[model samples]
Target: MFKKLVVGTLATGIVLTGGIGSASASTEGVENTKQVAPIAQKIKLETNYSSTNNQYGFTYTWDSNRQVYKTYDFYRHDGVFASYFESEGIKWYFKGKVRDLPGGGALGHYEGKK
Candidate 1:
């Protein structure tokens, strides 16, 4: 068990160091590295978009009338991205962000803006 754990740790370190070291070479390469490396991403918003929402789009009533808008925003992080949202004249802000842990999995935050 100890041998297995050591081997796994060593392997993970090698891959992370290698990929992260070269992540800035190119955009395509960065994406590939993100897939290989154990990057974390945490999406704050709920993305349960139905077919109707996609087709007709969802509505947000900011004022008495009604309005709706949404968007995706990011600051070009290694493996992190954010989402934006807007409701008619009303504006929204980012919720939370996710950072890569030492273990595995991806956790990201959904950021929003007008």
Candidate 2:
């Protein structure tokens, strides 16, 4: 009976400790919040185009103060008006917001025409 009890306790401990679970089970819910933390920082604009895809772009630098978020703008040959938008995480433009992504696809400072 004592040996059986010991074996039972060992089995329970192993299960509880995830010794017999899949590799992913160990990190089931332990999220890396730090990794998701907003990377707020200044960015250097890099791109040149009149009205084409990949017109204007920027590379953000790590900043100790501030959570970097996406900033959108329209680019036009004439400096009249500009459209603006913002987002965090992947892809500044999402499926839900696809409609909001400007039709003609202007770059840098969106204006009236949508």
Candidate 3:
């Protein structure tokens, strides 16, 4: 479990490094709300754009089923924007901590676009 978490974290970090920074530049519109506790959300996700492993493009179509998959830890640093993922019939974004585990899945805390 620890190994998986570590690997997942590293992978996610790589994904976010270039893609996320270049995507939005800064978490401009996103609020750094660290108060909300992350909830499990197994959102049905689809690729929004084609991205390779290390060279990632953080864009995806996600369902709003708030069950949890892993975590959005990678998204926390730069903060993800609506262009990154779409959910709940509206564009979605995240600026808090999140994570993804092997069997359990992703656990994320997101803030919808205002």
Best-fitting candidate, scored by TM-score: 3
Off by over 4 Å in 1: 1-47, 50-92, 101-107, 111-114
Off by over 4 Å in 2: 1-55, 69-75, 81-83, 86-114
**Which one wins by lDDT: 1 or 3?**
3
Q: lDDT values of the candidates?
A: 0.43, 0.41, 0.46
Residue-level lDDT tens digits of model 1 in 1-114: 999999999889879778656655556445455556567897455443222123324322222122222322222335443344444433455444445545543344332223
Query: TM-scores of the models, in the given order?
Result: 0.18, 0.18, 0.21
Better of 2 and 3 by TM-score: 3
Per-residue error for 19 in candidate 1, Å, reads 75
Give the root-mean-square deviation of each candidate in angstroms: 21.7, 16.6, 28.0
The window of 10 residues in a row where model 3 has the poorest summed lDDT is: 49-58
**Residue-wise C-alpha lDDT for candidate 2, range 14-97, written one tens digit per residue:** 888778654343555766834776789987654422333343453323222333222334333443332334423323332122
Displacement of residue 113 (Cα, Å) in model 1 is 8.1
Better of 2 and 3 by lDDT: 3
